[model samples]
Target: MDPVDSSAKSTPGSNGSNSASSLPGVASPPERSNSQSNKPSHIAAHRQSFAENQRYPPPSPHAHRHPSFTQQAIQDLLINPPSNRHANTRYAGRDWRDMALSELVPDEAKWADLDTSVEEATMTLLKNNTSNVVLIRKTSDSKTAISTFDPSDLNAYLLVVVGLAKPNEEHVAAYDEISKKAQSQTPISLREIQTLSRKEQLVVLPADSTLDGAIEAFGSGIHRILVTNQSREVTGVLNQLRLLEFFWNEAANFPVIDRLYGSLLRDLQIGTQQIIAINADAPLADALSLMSNEGLTSVAVVDHGLNVVGNISTADVRHLTNTTSLPLLKSSCMHFISVILSERGVERGRDSFPVFYVNPYSTLAHTVAKLVATNSHRMWVVESASPSPSAPATPLLQASHPVPTPAAAAAVGATSPPAPTILIPPTTSTSGPQSPLPGQSIAVVPSAALPGSRISGRLTGVVSLTDILNLFAKSSGLNPSDPSEQRARRRRSSSSSVRPTIEGGRTSVDIRR
Candidate 1:
């Protein structure tokens, strides 16, 4: 898009009637009324002179001064530089919106193999600074051949898994089982390692497509989408983080402030189905299960009343793995909440956790400001009057009070606290797609009362980086759908085929022409 022109100029004959006023049947401005004739002649002449002066202001009497040599050089360097002209693309001149997903995603060859062991995959993720791994398996289906398929009849079907972060109960158990077999001199099979990895459906788009399509795909609940070449071979993958980086780094190009101002959270399309939450009293295993199963980065923890008390995120899981044993995954969610709250110096009162929330009626500008101040990926939207009056009005963070480090905890004689006991009401049952283990119980909490035991506000929804991109797409007029003509062509060229399941316990990939 071209830069907007700001210089103002007057049209020809704008001060009086011209061709437009002379048009047939065009009415002219009304003449002064007879009552106005009572006004003094000097007063009318003064008014006409004032109007003319206002339209053609007098120029400044001061002479224009030439800039100093240094100032002139600086100005020349900035406006018409003799050097670094090629560096234009290195800065704001480049538009990320026009860039394709393939340009941003890493090469497919760097991805982990489907049969890679848990330990190896974890190491790869840490070394590469990536949380996900593209899992691929060899296939011999001639009908699904691509240009890059190996001549030896070996092609691969791809699935993705969240490979970083702490290992879940199932992953730990699988590792232990495999380790035991290996220690006993028994061989481990590729299938065993693959079974431990939780698979997610891979969304695919063409490599030539713009970022607008990527925003729409992510807004549709996809965590990442694999970019493919014209021959149907995987090229790269675009995830939420990369998309967010593009949005934030190119924020100046977007009119988010103007478009989102005064808009409510509900206008962003948030709903219960999009919320990934766990009961406060539930086990850490349950939270891990939810994250792994859904490929989520965080899960909200709520109380028996369904009020949001805190959040357990992948960062928290990483901290746990670095500081504690893997078995701690079996601990209750309340224990994790306490650890986080205590570390943050949040006192137990009407609200058990130090959660940041905004009202549903809050303006988008307010939300964006809070997001920038907190440096948070997402924030909870709650109803007004959620926190009880008895709850202490502690700020989100105190500058004077330092968070306790490991050494500080030891210096203060603080040790790992025991897990909190929860009394589960019989009426409460397991929530989400995962089922609770036998002998385990869960408390049922209403949506309005889930965050805390106190009379807190209900969790309406959440807003994230993806929502921001959606707003940008709308404001920039980048419609996220194929043209009607292209859609008809695609529909005519499309073929319906069911691809075989790449892995034993994984979902089958649905291939389309």
Candidate 2:
């Protein structure tokens, strides 16, 4: 005070005009006069305001906002070569799973103050390119955090939202009731369901089966194949789409196959060779998430030693969804028993199996005939059980059965008498858990608690399209059997929370999942 250091003493009351904001002992700019009469007053005022701001630090642009990035599977997210942030503690020590929810609602905001942004919401779903996101509807109880993204695979995720309506008791009761209902009353193997519906086939040709033979197999009856050696061990699944993609890209050398035939060979890359093969003992959700992420029809089921066993496909999952059965007799039945005119077989009767099982390693055209001959939806895709989870699945049927001409099964289906229709009783007849068992010990991460030790194969975690459809029926208060249920459910569940968005300029407050 006695002899002021002009740089430090300019502001007597302000302590340390000197920290990082200003260098230690450095003075802030001179204050401006309030007089309006001076010609230079306005400019001085502007400079003073700017200087005042310079003296104090400003808030971060991202302080109130969460930074979002387009990410692949959280494991693949580039943690930082250019930056040093550890993957384990990127955002408040939260893993990618927790980071996803934190972005939707930060902790600082009281429950009511959190108004989720459309921009942030869209970005939150960047990782899930395949599964639908059901938004969390705003409610009196904002404490309900969003359900986590359950992994379907490297490509899929599954979330169940209360679609089309806000939550209510009746909704809970419906799910409770249906879930408790009988799931499997018939001897309906997963195969029967696919056979009864339109069957999808992936083929596997012999290793000696030429590229030309493989191409001929394409578009015939199968969409995929397991290329195997003479002794019948799977080398790789020859994808029709990959061959077609090769043919399409190198069309000059490709033979003039049917354009219709060539199209199936074009690799849309829908299913890649690095198929996410899970241990048969792994969680059902593991298979579910994998297929969901990949958007594939099937997954090769394997054992601990990496040997292929069977494939639990989308067709199997479809069976899980459409468990409710109505009478399915399509044979010319009402007339065959009427006043005996003459016992004549109808053009297309139903008793003889149209398709039978084929080994996954054979030509697909032949597999299709197996599907018809055995009345199967899909053939058994099996490989010998080995000691690891990565082994190729061998189609057991392919190794043992004969792949007859398609005409063999076609002609038989036309001659047999239709079997009598079976009526499915109301769901209350059977007993099961109110919800499909959420897997246990199939830890969110690997269960390496005892590496090289064995685990059982009881984990089943996929939620069927039927499960999705059923959730929709409840929120909308629609009857348990509505067809639009599945469509509406799929649409509403595409977002993370069940909260509705303004669509077609109309706001529908009702939430039906």
Candidate 3:
């Protein structure tokens, strides 16, 4: 496969060579800093907590038994949902239903111009502590974005450029020495980045749209909706995580859904047991390639012994933009993880790499809390297994040759929009796994299990933000499984797609080196 051609040829649908100098409302880019000490202390704290395996104790069984009137009112609102105009009326007429999405804009939201460099955008994400940077055109009056550039996009770019640039070279030699020489700094613009990105149109909701409308959008399988003001200028982004975080923080006010928080994941049938893992000893490039080809955001990192030691995410790919971190792509996933931790200040006393995992018995509320606290998108579901030491470690799927990462390969077709027509899959639907894993299905060597304990058992499954938000959608009468009721409740959104279609059994290809 050819390396990504970053020449000035215009990508389809992009405005040609628009300069970013005069874009209104575009924030000045932060100064480039290579100093490790300049990184945010809070980010370090969050990563440190994750590295330590901070687990939340489940709420007391009686925690929701007796609720205040306001709590009951909120619960009643959810259980017996009020009409669109009155959605928030039950909670003492707070008018949340009438409230505009503008009010929910996060303070740290970041934006970029199409002319912004990939390296600059990468720095913006790290310095601002944000996941995505909305890319807008320089000449447009309205802050309409062409696409959102994220860490995953950066990862896809680098993998194509560095990892797969020389396919004929030995894997060890190609990966180990590619970054050692002085590399040319190509100023790849955000416009080109969008051309190569997953072609999902931005889902925009007018800022004046009601909270209830926003809820419905999320329920309809739209992972994120851009909140644009009256001028059609992008102001904020609303996603499943922020919405769920709001619910969690205000649990006291919403009694109906609050009671469900204490239910164990197993009881609720929440999360999918289908998981994808990579050997810690494998090259980091292999993990990146695995995620790229599979359309995954994260993958669990396990040791040769089949014990999940930690996790490596496409988000971690952002760190590679720096000179100090890029060379590690050729290194083992385990070593790359260590450098990542050291940069985050978690290497102070930690020897073992940490992973975000939960047992099947963990409560929904606790899992949500950890996700919010750590700003993580997914958690592994593991169960204790005392595999005989002699039992060979779980085997990896093998391939005899090299496969191109998304960046190096020909443009794949755009994924379909979320379908508003189908019933949401039951939380435990047996849709075949999306990516490769150790053996068929998660190796669920179920031994004695403890709910909140930190045992690195065999990987069973994963729970994600999408899973939890879908539950909320179900409660709000959006994703009823019954065909009759589903038809009645079906309200199509321009941006919705069924989750199962995305994860439906694609053959798993091994990307391990």
Candidate 4:
């Protein structure tokens, strides 16, 4: 196959070209001091001779008064560019000129053997501050077992899997029911939690793979990919969040719109239209149900007045699941949140749950920096004032509430005005949250709180890895309005073609290498 043309044409100012005078809209640069002309005649003559002897012919006298050929060429390319003959070969080969996966993957990656239980594996992930674990399954005889296990093994001993304490809704619900039924019984075994061994396939690439390949892998839709050695031994794992973080860190290098620098959290379309939040008084079961039904990884916990109190996430849930005395699914979310916060020394009056958040008017750069610094997947985009004390708190989703259909939401005006929809895999049911009761409101609360008083600010929306990726897509010229470009963007954003499957009460993520 012909090598892919990965070259990117540099813009005028980008290539150390002081072509301000040649640019269409830019003002010409100030004239240099004539003191240089006072240099010795010998030095001036030597410089002139050097310029004349250069391989390229000297510019015409009119070049100083008009656009140079190079500038005109650039303008022509910008106005009506030549089609790339090798457009089809964009990702045909691994030639990511300067960027590499090594620049993205962290140095301290955690590894585990197949014998490691889910609890141990999750703790390892938490300790290592990573979202994934590399599973090394030893094999004495490669041929027979490799064929018996998976045809695509490629003699690799290591595999990667996300650290989910409970892989699926079914498992969580079943475990909850069992725990409640047998309250006096012994705790569940650690083995009950799904481990890396359960995953059907692993996404792996050689350590020297290009960032373009990594981007392609992530765009294909898998959450993370494992870097392997020549022997197929795991080296590190690159997560979707990390990829976004990398992009944010290197945003200056990428082609970005001028408006991006001036854009704020509110300016960019981010977060859910209606923030799907839960009452602190609600049962943990309710939170889990909402998460499963809404296809959310985290949910805000609010007070009686719809003021934000705390946040609960998959990580919190995972830790809760491992405890010997797992809280009853019906237990209050506040109790769980309080316990977690206390354990982490996350005092009240401070930011609840150490959750990172930003004001609506905050710049995109500030938001991106916060996300990177916190190593967080999402940040709450909050307002400057808390909900009024007199106002009733937002209604929490109840088991009794029927899932709302689009018609119902439209009739009640519970839904926000429709925005540009990104084509991610459907996370929630076809019929999502129900319309609020006639007078019900969706008031938010401060993500952070003061000890004695209600804090200013209300939760508005969230900016997540998904949103950042969408922004990157738009800024990079993948027009969201174009169907072909949209499809290409989606194809490049996901790492997996097949979604995770649940079988025999265990969820197995199928990742393609």
Q: Pick the candidate with the highest TM-score.
A: 3
The digit string of per-residue lDDT tens for model 2 on 250-349 reads 3233223112221211121111122234544454444544444334454445444433433444423211121111110111111111101111111133
Rank all candidate structures by their TM-score, best first, as comma-separated numbers.
Answer: 3, 4, 1, 2
State, as a TM-score between 0 and 1, how close model 4 is to the true structure: 0.49
Please say which candidate is ahead in TM-score: 1 or 2: 1
Alpha-carbon lDDT, every model = 0.45, 0.29, 0.54, 0.45
**TM-score of every candidate relative to the true structure:** 0.47, 0.21, 0.59, 0.49
Query: Please, what are the lDDT tens digits per residue for candidate 3 over residues 1-513?
Result: 212222222333334443322222222334445774577788656654563543533333233222324677786554434322222433533534466777776534467777666555655665655435445556445466767766666666676556353222334453333223214333456655453334444678887787777776565445577877677777677887788877776665565567677788889887665456787669888888766655567888764544565678877775555332344566677555554544443324433335477777777877877788767878887767535243334322221122322221212233432211101111232242221111111111111121222337666678887677767657655552322222123222212122222124531212243
**Could you tell me the lDDT of residue 159 within candidate 3?**
66
In the range 55-147, model 1's lDDT, one tens digit per residue, is 644332122212235676686454422321122244345555676767667664334443443333333433444424433444422212111
Query: For each candidate, C-alpha RMSD in Å?
Result: 18.8, 30.3, 25.9, 20.3
Strongest candidate by lDDT? 3
Task: State the lDDT of candidate 4 residue by residue for 235-277, as single tens digits.
Answer: 5678768877655544434435223744776677654433556
